[model samples]
Target: MVSLICTLQDHRDDVNWCAFSPTLLATCSADKTVRIYNTQDFSEVPYSPLSGHGYGVHCCCFSACGQYLASCSTDGSTVVWSTDTGEIEAVLEHPGRNPVRVCAFSPDSSHLVSGASDGTLGLWDFRTKTLHRTGAVNDTTMVACSFTPCGQMFVTGSTYGDLRLWDLDMNQLHAEKNTHDLGVTCCCFGPKILSGSGTVQFRLASCGQDSTLKIWTVSRSNTGSCKMQLLHTLTGQSAPVLSCAFSADGQLLVSGSVDKTVTVYDASQGTLLYTLNQHERYVTACAFSPSTPLFATGSMDKTVNIWRVEDGHSGHVETATFSCEGRKLLCHSRLLVSDWSEEDVGAWLCEEGLQALVENFKANNIDGAELISLTKETLASELNIESVGLRSKVLRKVEELKAGCVCTGVPDEYLCPITRELMKDPVIAADGYSYEREAIESWIATKNRSSPMTNLPLQTTLLTPNRTLKMAIGRWRTSQ
Candidate 1:
């Protein structure tokens, strides 16, 4: 595994907020400049220097769709920038004291929220470019506020060590929890909305200067009473947590801390998975990709370090499939997506489907050169799992195609079953390698063992589901 660290060309002065985009990343610093860098080459890109704020930029974030960026400044002003043109589209000023430290956009891109040192929270409508509401927050200087993915609710935290959840509809406090000992620097919501498992509408996580991280299970009872329950507290670290981000699936959490370390933990179990001690100074911000199983951490060390997780592969074998399906299922089960685009999505899924075919061929014990010849002619053919059947001769052809290739897919194990989208850290596997919907089809084709199964005229029915399942079928067995 190769790890790359990114640093600015000129050292930034008092950089406060940094956000990642699909193709580029933006950073706001005290030097009165916002620098945008290409994610691929780490090269600095030309971005118009925004200078309306009198003092400095404090916090910034990219919209969920990556179309707009919102930033707050010490001058109690907020501006929305067009990601394509690097032009300021809207400038909003809050008549508050001191600086506006943090701002976030709702998931729908309709509302923007800013928290200030003046202990006030300001809300604005991005569509109308008008202030919608302003309210006095708790004594804690409201530093960070984020809307839940649903956009119906938002949570705000402050230096006074208070966390408050609000309902935008009723314009009332849904719940309030004062559990931190210091300034609450960062917070994130869990990916999965709790439904049938219990009343959990969402999971909230926050970190503060108290050197403690807490997780809360927030639920709305049928009677309309919102309850915030303390779920777990992580307290092994001695440093104040600066920023926290949940993995794509909320299965894992990553925290950047003043202790110069980035810690990874199982969000559900609160188990420390790994600690990256490579940064030289305090870690400022951490983010995980929704498309790929990779994490990015920005630090006072003035660098963004990228790290990847490893998944184990069994072995390669060859098999023959005499039967032929009309079309193929292009499964990109193993390809990793750091930032996905339309073209990337199509290419990844196609590659993964072919990879599944290749693995099946090898497991059936097929030859290499023959597989290469098959891929050269058939890879571009559109194939869906519903149309494919597991006949022995067909499986052999799949082996032939994959042996001619390297890197069948991404290394992450918890991938989407259909689209083969790489699950983020804390990813939960609802089904097979792809999304849940596609996983069922994969299972039917690869499994469904009861009577004798047929690849060609040959009948092999003794194989149980466990034996034929992708998780178990291996070409090389040590015990054997």
Candidate 2:
């Protein structure tokens, strides 16, 4: 089930756009400020309420590494802020000084593109903070932009109802005119790339004033030619779809609409999954977290709602649940890693492409439990494997096996009492119980000092970092 976890009401004006990094969420508004929040607990970051924009900010996006955030505004510039300290790193003035409507970072964060109200686009070299090239379309405001996964090309949508593809040099590769009856509002490229023979294919989603969301397949052949074909036209929302985003895994798609609703879809099949009606005003922006089963939607109601995808509802799978050939390997049909016999260990070694060490592992009688306990020292002293590279490879594969076991079994103690999720940063509260740091902090802030487990008042609000528990959880995670 999908549920709203929290509603952020920090913005005093309409929230124009929202973006998520690995650990932070940024929301821009017509209030002329950008706010940053900790994704862990939805608390405002200490350095939030970024006021670098001179005018109302229209859009914001995070760099690939989450190190920087770029925001564009009616000030006719895109300003880059350091995510670490919320300081302005650079200010890129859009060519022709037109109001910048949207901005995006390339897959590698090497380039930044800002679309303007005057139909002009500024391609900036992120490292140098300089304009690399400028391009424009006649009589149309450039409002939407997204970079393909390959980083070699990007797609732009305009008020003219056209979706145009361009290379890094600002040359138009293909233009799908009249993509929407009225105009395109937003567009995004899926994270995954499909390749076969001499062609590489990408999935692109565009929403427009026509009240429809369209999915298209963009293909680039070995001969360097590009083509775009419409794949699906989704009409899940009753009004104009203003924004759309693809999940990190590209398995799900979400869109915000003028009908004051948010729609989620099974992206691969273009089938509607859920229609959420929690916002009282037009939903203007939506984004998915890069590292979690969470998404955020911003609305003209001056709020941003955070939603979580429940465990089974999320279309995520453990990498270990599949064989090398991409066939499903049922965990119930095989022995757990901790219970595997010596023969099982040997077979696993072979399957991992360590056939040369199968005999060595068998000779050592390294059962599953023992395999989990193996260290570099054990490999060198006990197994007498002296090749450093091979030892490293084996250890890496073993770590992968451990990580694969996380979904099957995670220690209850390693989970936070409030969230019941594995604690990445465990801390001890005044109640003398360990919990996830952010989870407990948020709890104390909202529940008025009550201990989550004991149901009694906490004497103090102080929290101490539980280093030992954190290390233990880390090791367990590596072993899982």
Candidate 2, pairs of clashing residues: 402-479, 402-480, 403-480
| Cα RMSD for predicted model 1 | 23.9
Q: Model-by-model lDDT, in order?
A: 0.59, 0.85
TM value for model 1 = 0.61
lDDT of 1 by residue, 291-406 (tens): 55556677654355555544421222112121112111122222322223334333322332333454434443333333334432243342222333333334443443243122
Please report, as a residue range, the 10-residue window in candidate 1 with the lowest summed lDDT: 449-458
Which of the numbered candidates is closest to the native, going by highest lDDT? Answer: 2
Clash totals in order: 43, 3
lDDT of 2 by residue, 59-152 (tens): 9999999999999986678999999999999999888666789999999999999998778899999999999999999888888999999999
Task: Give the runs in model 2 whose Cα sits over 4 Å from its true position.
Answer: 313-480
